[model samples]
Target: MIIGKVIGNVWATRKEESLNGMKLMVVRRLDTESGCEQESFVAVDCVGAGIGERVLVTTGSSARMALDNPNKPVDATIVGIIDEVEVRAEG
Candidate 1:
């Protein structure tokens, strides 16, 4: 899973049939070591996450599974809304 911050939403009235009713949002990844915002990309949101909130994103095949639509063309999915994160430096 990747940690990201919800940046915005994607509204597409015309989309693939399999992607209908999906709530897509823009998420910016946070650097694992510094926890700073990185590149931003769109992702399907299954957890009703809103902008400015930190979220856990899953990618690849698992992303499709998160929505229970294995056949859907989902490369990324928001699986959880994160409350906090704590990373320890390597010993």
Candidate 2:
């Protein structure tokens, strides 16, 4: 799983039939330790995540599982909207 922030939306009028109803968003990867934003990528939204919200993303085969469809042709999917993130310093 990857922690990211929804930065924007993706509008594809012509896409695969299986992805017709899927909401796609651009999610910028977040560095848990430094709170830095990294590269962004499009991900299918399964949890109704909106722009600016922090989200949890699943990728690869697991991403397909999040949608409950293995043939959705998606490499990434937003599985959860994050409420908060707390990182503690290891002693």
Candidate 3:
């Protein structure tokens, strides 16, 4: 899973039939250790994550499994909304 932050939303009036009711969100990948932001991408929102919230994202075939459909044409999916993150520094 990749750690990211919800930056915005995606609204597509017409989409694949299998994705009719799925909520889409824009997420920017975050460097958990340095707190730096990276590339932003679209993801299917499985949890009720909103803008500015930290989230857990699953990509590739695993993302399809999260939605219980392997043919949904989704490459990324938000699986959880993170309340907090604790990173330990290496010695």
Root-mean-square deviation (CA) per prediction? 1.3, 1.1, 1.2
How far does residue 29 in candidate 2 sit from its true spot (Å)?
0.2
Model 3: which residue pairs collide?
none
Q: Write the per-residue lDDT of candidate 1 for residues 1-91, one digit (tens) a residue.
A: 9999999988998889898988989999998668878899999999989999999999988888887758889999999999878777672
Off by over 4 Å in 2: none
Task: Give candidate 1 regions above 4 Å deviation.
Answer: none
**C-alpha lDDT of candidate 2 relative to the true structure:** 0.91
Candidate with more favorable, higher TM-score: 2 or 3:
2
Better of 1 and 3 by TM-score: 3
| TM of each candidate vs. truth | 0.90, 0.93, 0.92
- State model 1's lDDT: 0.90
Q: Which candidate should be chosen as best, given TM-score against the real structure? A: 2
Ranking the candidates on TM-score from highest down gives 2, 3, 1
lDDT over C-alpha atoms for residue 20 of model 2: 90
Least well predicted 10-residue stretch by lDDT in candidate 2: 82-91
Estimate candidate 3's alpha-carbon lDDT, on a 0 to 1 scale.
0.92
